[model samples]
Target: MDDRKKNKEAEKVTITPSDESTSEKGHLFGLDETIESIKDAISDFESGKILNIAIIAPSYAGKSVLVDEIVNIYSHEVTKVSFSSIITDKEEIPLSEDQSKIMIFDNCHYLYMRKIGGFEVLHAFLNMVLEQDARLCISTWNIHSWNYLGRVLDIRKYFPVQIKIPPLNSSQMKEFLLSEYEDGEILFVNDVEAEDKQIFHVVKKPLAEKATHGRIKLYTLKVNYVALRSLLMNKGTPDETAESIIIKEITRISRGNPGVAKKLWKKWLEYPIIKTSNIDKFSPSINIDVDSRFILYLILSMGYIKKCELNNIMNWKCSVDDIRINMILFELLNQELIQINDEYYSIRADKLHLVTKYLEDCRLVW
Candidate 1:
């Protein structure tokens, strides 16, 4: 393999360990390319020139994992310091030659706003990197926020080399599943392996449905692959007589969020005989601003809310016009917090659960 390919292999191995005991399968999937590019970039830094690399993508695109892997691989060769949010002057951790080697700031997108002194700590840190000329600073952020920060911070002239980590495409998703699951051969029985698509499309139907009234869909296979690997490792795979229904059900619940998938999968192992229908009991509702409640309620009610029903429900309490609801709904969709198609709006269930719960506790659920 070429040096690039070799680096990719190293990145892959670092993500999923050969020994199943210590691995979190989520790390292994959807990152080799980005990691390889980052390693190569780090190599450039080691040769004496400083480089500020940015990892930009949508939320939950695994930016943190990418940074962690790169930091781990080049721990000794470079100095690594990381941050997630805006740094206050008092909270600022100075980056010095002795303390600074390769700096990895996890969420540089948080530095856009002006605080007392305006991202004072981040400004100082970046200036330090510029003056020192020996530090390599790699940072990650949601692409939208990154764009705003880039414009505000004049990031173009400062950190010219930006690397964008695209979300997991279908092909990457399949590879991720195979690497995580033992029955990789069986799971991908047809040409369409679990990793066959960028997003794993699984139905989100309630148990009693023969034909989904209005189906909810999730990329559960990809989301929960890492969590599933961990859970399966704990319980041991089923024998010939054992069923794989639990695996499918667990994946469905995860809807492709690693954190949620892992949590739900772990809970599943504790009680393996649970039914898919019972999964609903384990789910939670999220709380968001009341202005955004109508659409959210529609989503929580299982991805399809009739316009007439929504209007009737709202008419009982508030007079939110259709235009207002439509506007806020569009905004949420843009944020990837919700998805709408064919006159139906569906909450990104993963985010909805948490946001809804918060709103309810705050008594803001509309």
Candidate 2:
């Protein structure tokens, strides 16, 4: 594999012997509440509560890290199975034959198809988990796939205790990233104001009370109106420091995602110095057309894609209707929203959050 592929692989969550231990390496910021919740669920399960867990989080949100810790803690007691992204077959997930009463599945989303309402493997897996009383199952899924499945199958019903990991704040982000480096080794440059920001054109969406459950749906079309209004109208200009500005920018661009923030930090770091003046915020000017948007979501859903992969995904989605694949690819290439390396097209790490935000605004990130 190439260096790029190696780097991508490095970004993927993996299990190590140290992860199974109560070492400092397993420590994570802003996850105390989540860890407590998982412990409580485990306690309940031990008490014959049968509350299997669904650890739901967005892509690259450290779901695997958390799950690895859990499995490491219970390695001697439970059976563990991890699914890979390259998986295209829906084979039967094997059961443990060593009389283990608990099982843990990572990337349970891989069991299902990405198409709308396509849950053949997931449905089977859920049945297997729900039907058997001899085994207690803990599964994790991508937030997007979970939401889609919830809409179609009410997936929450299967797992009574659902743990939705919350995003970290600026302070948490600082402490988290700072753990990787020593004091005075890195500097943050802060900037003020929202003047001359790039404009992103999005399709105006209409929401009914039944559809959105609240009036906030009306505010979906206004991009960052809350933040922009606060910055321009309510907030006062004070003496800003480099650390504060860097944290804010990191929080904004990464959307409080740990993985994305780590990648951004690596890119921004210039040996021993980082300046906000040099940090260019990439606020993408999104063109929210349906076909292009759908294609982006499908690609994001899977880490990387080939033409054949998209065809398989569209097969389940029934979305290959009157759309020119070549034209869309060309347009995306021109826009630089995605990058193609050796015929395998993938999103650039720097633009991950921009693409995610665009898809989220389109309600495709869910």
What TM-scores do the predictions have? 0.47, 0.75
Candidate 1 structure quality by residue, lDDT tens digits, 281-333 = 33334334665764554344322333444444454334547776666666777
Q: What C-alpha lDDT, on a 0 to 100 scale, does residue 210 get in candidate 2? A: 77
Model 1 regions more than 4 Å off: 1-26, 84-86, 97-100, 110-117, 184-349, 352-366
RMSD of each: 15.5, 9.2
TM value for model 1: 0.47
Instruction: After superposing candidate 2 on the true structure, give the runs of residues whose Cα lies further than 4 Å from its correct spot.
Output: 1-27, 86-90, 96-98, 115-117, 189-237, 303-307, 316-334, 339-349, 360-366
Q: Which of the numbered candidates is closest to the native, going by highest TM-score?
A: 2
Q: Kindly give the stretch of ten consecutive residues in candidate 1 with the minimal lDDT sum.
A: 1-10
Q: Global CA lDDT of candidate 1, please?
A: 0.50
